[model samples]
Target: MRQYLILLLLFTLVQSAVTDSPRRPNSNPPKGFVTTKGSKFVLDGKPFYFVGTNSYWVPLLTTKEDVESTFKQMKNAGVKVLRTWGFNAINGSELAAARNSDLTYYQVWNSTEWVLNDGPQGLQRLDNVIAMAGKYNIKIILTFTNNWVGYGGSELYVNWIGGAGSTHDVFYTHPKIIASYQRYVKTIVNRYKTSPNIFAWELMNEARCLGDLPGGPSCIPGSGTLYHWYNQQANFVRSLDPYHLITTGGEGHFYWKKPVGFWYNGQFISDYNFNGQAGEDFDRDLTLENIDFGTYHIYPQYWYPQLDTPGSNFTLKAWGIDWIKLHAKAAKRVGKPVILEEFGVTGLENKTDIYPAWVDSALSTGHGIMPWQFGALGLTENGGNRVIKYADALINGASPNDGHAFYENQTTVWNVFTNAAKVQDAKSK
Candidate 1:
């Protein structure tokens, strides 16, 4: 069985089942709009940098009337950009409403995350987020998926959303599943192809469709469906929009260095067939240009001191530097600049937060870095009140302007990130 090769047609049918929202206005790149590689973003030929905690409060800073006020806060702090999350809770009551509905499965069980809802389920709320980002001159690295991968459970449901996976996602070799992916991607990209503020496409969040095992899977549609799945995805992003750049959210360690036959390289060479590329001398870039850019993730406690958080002091930022060098080298090897998409240090671990310094070293070396998060995760109000409390100081106090201080538990990483906010004056320009 050749297994569904009518790619373009199969994509069409899949969209009918998952289709929700009607088309909206989109922002296309202007004529001759070439995104040049610079220290920061180059919108229409200028320098830029997206710096800020993955801000949760910034989006809701001030009253509803001043939604853009958060971006201003970043600007005020001399921060140029904020790595904003997709779904955010507007009304706490909605959380209850979603739980009562059949929507929980669609949202990775995180009702507070608004991005998971498709169609009218969360259209208005999402629009406000996009509008707020635009109003503040903030460019977004909008991720379609969440950190649902490693958490397990219902994530399998999300993974199987369209055909074993969509056009690029070859989760399983299932017939209809692969077809469904093709359609799902076409629908989503066609709807948003022209959004100027949508900096790029992040197909999913930290996904590992293929298990971490040797001789597991590869680029070909075979034992390892993850590679084929990713190819379908990466290709879909390019075909539908053909404007904005795109990359996998973060497939974890494999994103950077994979085994000789790993899927990242295997999909093109065949993961199960490492020697398959030996005929071509295993040229690394065969599928390198298949994607627009490169992305990677890191777990410090796992890689560095191996000490559980608050106790470990793994300071290599090893992947960060290697990512820049490897991907940039790889990008140049294939003609693209690398993007350091996701990396996070647990704020819940041992009171010390080394992430800020970690990030500083990476970006100072001049790689595009999007730290894990902001808002309730790192710098949100504590002890539950309208008041905003940033984990800037271990002491836990109110922000300026008399905002109250509330905290869950203060980690050293929190204060370092808060302090680093001042160091990122580069974004303002």
Candidate 2:
């Protein structure tokens, strides 16, 4: 009897240890879901060097036909993956004042609490997008929220919980705010956790210490705060959905211990992007055990005007290429895949001149690339080709002529992506 009691105690201790052990990578991801395999994305036991595009308004459109048309155009262009907005937060007053009664929204803040919209004008819109994507054989990376104010983002949450004078960064640490965000996350993740078409779940779109509104007095300017928030949120997502991949939808800013300076035209800026001012440290963020891959964006025309000039020795093209190489190197160091998730240049001629070289760089470095947007061509009243736009991107009938969108009519620019997709597909096989 004494010997048996000792043996049972030992067995109980061993089981407890196993229960407390850290989670291992999902060795057997479900079929048709994307997973990482040592510095590359693998889908169904094959390398997935996907060339995709962003279409944030796909879920916000009022008509299912428009959604199908968008997916059809993307499929024809050889796009295998797409990154889009999976969040739409609004207050009741805003919804009431909307011009269209059929406006789509996912969550609504009703003065004191959040009411999730799972009806036809809410998450059902997203359901349509996922259904169409699966039908078209494309995967989706769904971003949970935005850092900007264009679509009720972090600021909206701040306003909701912290009230009138709250800072944007409070969305990261405040317990109430975090709980609310996670409630929405849990609802969405649980609803579609079994979907094979979900490529990944992004924590936020371009998460930063500051947003369109001010940071106020309580914001921290380093990587620690956001890092903590990322670990918390990412682990939560992983806990709920172990099969799908996860990523931080960041702009890939660095807060290096030994920061590197680069020459931008004639100026040597030491600490613009590399500094921790934005509270983003790409290297540090990627190191979190739950984070499966890394992502970075390139918008030299907007972020670094000095490099955007043509005829310069170090033009935007050169800088953008180097950026791709840098992130690829980091991905290798961390033993994970890194994607040049977004890149774009203004003007059709500039895009024609610059994007091919950037695409080639991403391919050479074994990194995936998605441009800022992909636009579809629609017929005007006179039967002329006009670009279909939605949400805040609507200007006349065209998408935000932010000059970054690659519309179907711009064949030269469109071909750059289609050809890259073909090359990527060939490499994957």
lDDT leader: 2
Inter-residue clash pairs, candidate 2:
none
User: lDDT per residue, candidate 2, 109-220, as tens digits?
Assistant: 8764689889888888899999899999999999989999765677778887878777888899888898788888889899888999899999999988888777645545
RMSD (CA, Å), each prediction: 9.8, 6.0
TM-score of each: 0.59, 0.88
lDDT of 2: 0.81
For each candidate, the alpha-carbon lDDT, in order, equals 0.43, 0.81
Question: After aligning candidate 2 to the native by TM-score, how far in Å is the CA of 320 from where it should be?
Answer: 0.5
Which candidate number maximizes TM-score?
2
Which portions of model 2 show Cα errors greater than 4 Å? 1-25, 99-101, 216-223, 259-269, 306-314, 379-400
Q: Report the C-alpha displacement of residue 147, candidate 2, in angstroms.
A: 0.5
Candidate no. 2 TM-score: 0.88
